[model samples]
Target: MPKPSSTKKVKTIPVPKSIRIDLTGHQYGRLTVLGFAGYRESAPMWKCQCDCGTVADYYRCNLRSGTSTQCVQCRHADLGVRSTTHGQWGSPEYRAWEKVRQSDNVCKRWQSYENFRKDVGPKPSKDHQLSRKVTTSAWKPSNVHWVHRDNVVQQKSNSHLIRFRGRTQTLTAWAREVDLSPAALRSRLESGWTVREALTTEALH
Candidate 1:
């Protein structure tokens, strides 16, 4: 008699449970939900009409969490009006101020563009950005300064930089210094390789 052949059992993946929330005809801030737009990244999306008479698709979570309200046109309109009133609209200074304000990271006093200008004065160049001297602290006149974009980028990149071989540098910087691609170095790190091994390993052609 022929010996019985072994059969391998396959595991079935369970279907993900969907949590549905109906938001049709509901008003959230300046947005009125019209109907479902479809799914995005596995999350439900809704079609909404803004008070400005524009229709856009928004994530259901953003609508319910109050993250997004009006359309982009309305936001730009408000920024333009407020910035023009301060005589700094369309200027680099105004753009920097608007960036901070939109993030809701500004101090109450800075809410007024005039007050913000009075404190920060003006941007030295188009490449200058508003930066907080103490990042952990709130955005206040005394804690903020205008810094060159390059310096800001360096500071941010350096914050989470790694050190190897008694030399400290960002992953990109180290990769460039060693003639290795940054993406490859990152991939090695992600694959549980030690930092020293990741940086020193030769790329396979």
Candidate 2:
């Protein structure tokens, strides 16, 4: 009763009417969104539990975009593997395997160096390198080879590199996936069509 007599009704600020996407219970790589962590500036943040059991806050966009897949400790741990030379961890041969591996060109059956070597054979010399026969096609015995670095063909100036679903490919490769003309897709992209719209919408002509 005493408080009610003295206190006056003051205007209160309302929470901003922003589009909030609830990512609770969603897992993005090693980080799983546990709950909200308020806002960083105007952007929302999420409280995530890493695979290593570290709980921390990260930006919503980063988690949603697949940019931040793991905690810092886990990333550092990964470098430990990269620091080795047993598998020639950072060597060109390893990189060649990694490149195709990440792009889903090679399957899990070819994961180990032994299997890769069995299929790919030993490198003839230091100058020899692995090359993909078809940029878009999956990597297999018939689709890959070893060639001298100097003998590699230079890509053309007009060749465009576009990324889709975490894999970067030449515009020509993407064209194979679309039923419409590659020119039409290129035109759509050039005309500011979103990736989804350009890839999905069929042309009348």
Candidate 3:
């Protein structure tokens, strides 16, 4: 029979009997190793504080050397009530909205124009000229106009605009449904017709 090979035993450093930590020049006695966080692939390993007032300072190699330490625990109690709002802007849906909102010139111009008018009054002024710079490829000067609050709401109630069927419809179809010509509907919409009046007159016809 072959002779049994001798196995070398690895020695481990034992936790100290007690630990002391100085916080703001005052000595804290019961500080224990809580958790650890640092670059795993580099030097300057960190020590975690425990409940027993012990601190475990080991090298990154030492941490990998054994599995004694761990990262912080996820506290469920701390999470409290869940929020009903949307996720952060970095999420997929938010990112998609953000991409169009930021990059698409047509959408950007519409938003900017509306905001500008709301904030600093109607455009077409020397300063407001900048706001009019935005337009869709098909946008025309005659097709754009300021509308009153009531007229705006009236035009929005059309089935075409509201989408009664599975498919989405256009403003032109809504206008046609109410017996108003496309030019008339566009005129009213651009002039700020309300959804209520727009839908009523269109539907009545």
The TM-scores, one per candidate, come to: 0.54, 0.42, 0.21
**Model 2 Cα shift for residue 171 (angstroms):** 3.6
Error of 3 at 71 (Å): 71
* Pairwise TM-score winner, candidates 2 and 3: 2
lDDT of prediction 1: 0.65
Q: Comparing candidate 1 with candidate 3, which one achieves the higher TM-score?
A: 1
TM-score top scorer: 1
- Please state the error at residue 179 of candidate 1 in Å: 27
TM-score of 2: 0.42
**Backbone clash total, candidate 2:** 0
Candidates in order have lDDT scores of 0.65, 0.59, 0.33
Per-residue lDDT over 84-182 for candidate 2, one digit per residue giving the tens place of the 0 to 100 score? 635566556666665555432364566665466678876778987776665444567777788787765453214456667787766657767866666
The candidate 2 region of ten consecutive residues with least summed lDDT is 1-10
Count clashing pairs, candidate 3. 28
**Which digits, one per residue and each the tens of the lDDT, describe model 3 over residues 1-205?**
1212431232233322221222211112222222233322222234544333234443333233232232222111111121123223243323323233332222334333333233333333222122121222212233244434454444444422434345445767765676766666554433333444344532211
Query: Which pairs clash in the backbone of model 1?
Result: none
Ten-residue stretch with the least lDDT total in model 1: 1-10
